[model samples]
Target: MTDEPDDLSDQPPLVQALLLARYTLVIHSGMRAVSEGETWKLDFASQIAEIDAALQTAGIDTTKPMFAPVKW
Candidate 1:
């Protein structure tokens, strides 16, 4: 990927926190429901896919460490 100015690390702290929280909730709930033999909802899976797409489109490096030392 070419060097992109807009990366996940470039986002504000609050935005990062919110995104992480949302991701955690969705993944945790989805896993629990599946493990309990509950019918999995496609909506949750779609949301995750959407999130992944959005992140990728935003030039965010999903493969790298999200929290790195910020040199101020």
Candidate 2:
């Protein structure tokens, strides 16, 4: 079998949208717990909020913010 890779940039519109949504979610989640300090949490929360709006504007399903409240 050949080891050729598929070009995601040339994917179907629907497929591209799905991939974009997944990427946005992953990035937002990654930034949510960068530092353990409260200050970092606040910054991350703010960043997530902005990203959510931007993603929604770009037709992504960023309906929920990535900041999950601490259970402690």
Candidate 3:
């Protein structure tokens, strides 16, 4: 119970958007596939899609980070 809560709002808007996008991609493609059943997959995809749409509507860039390749 002592674990501190991690708040995304503490991050910049663009960074928050990018972090959400990264998490959505990973959960949709990786963990959910094995851990979730059929019904949950659709729900998860729908939710992720909504988040992505909202991020785009807010003008957050979705392009792959240029520095990611070099840094990784």
User: In candidate 1, which residue ranges exceed 4 Å CA deviation?
Assistant: 1-10, 13-18, 34-43, 65-72
lDDT of 3 at 60: 52
- Candidates in order, TM-scores: namely 0.42, 0.33, 0.39
Give one digit per residue, the lDDT tens place, for model 3 in 22-56.
Answer: 56564555343334445333245566666667766
lDDT of each model, Cα atoms only?
A: 0.54, 0.49, 0.52
- CA RMSD of all predictions: 6.7, 12.5, 11.3
The TM-score of predicted model 1 comes to: 0.42
Minimum summed lDDT over a 10-residue window in model 2 is located at 62-71
What is the per-residue lDDT of model 2 for residues 7-63, given as tens digits with 9 covering 90 to 100?
446556764555455545555653545445543322345555665566557665544
Segments in model 2 whose C-alpha atoms lie over 4 Å from true places: 1-6, 33-72
Rank the candidate models, highest lDDT first. 1, 3, 2
lDDT pick, better of 1 and 3: 1
* Error in Å for residue 24 of model 3: 4.9
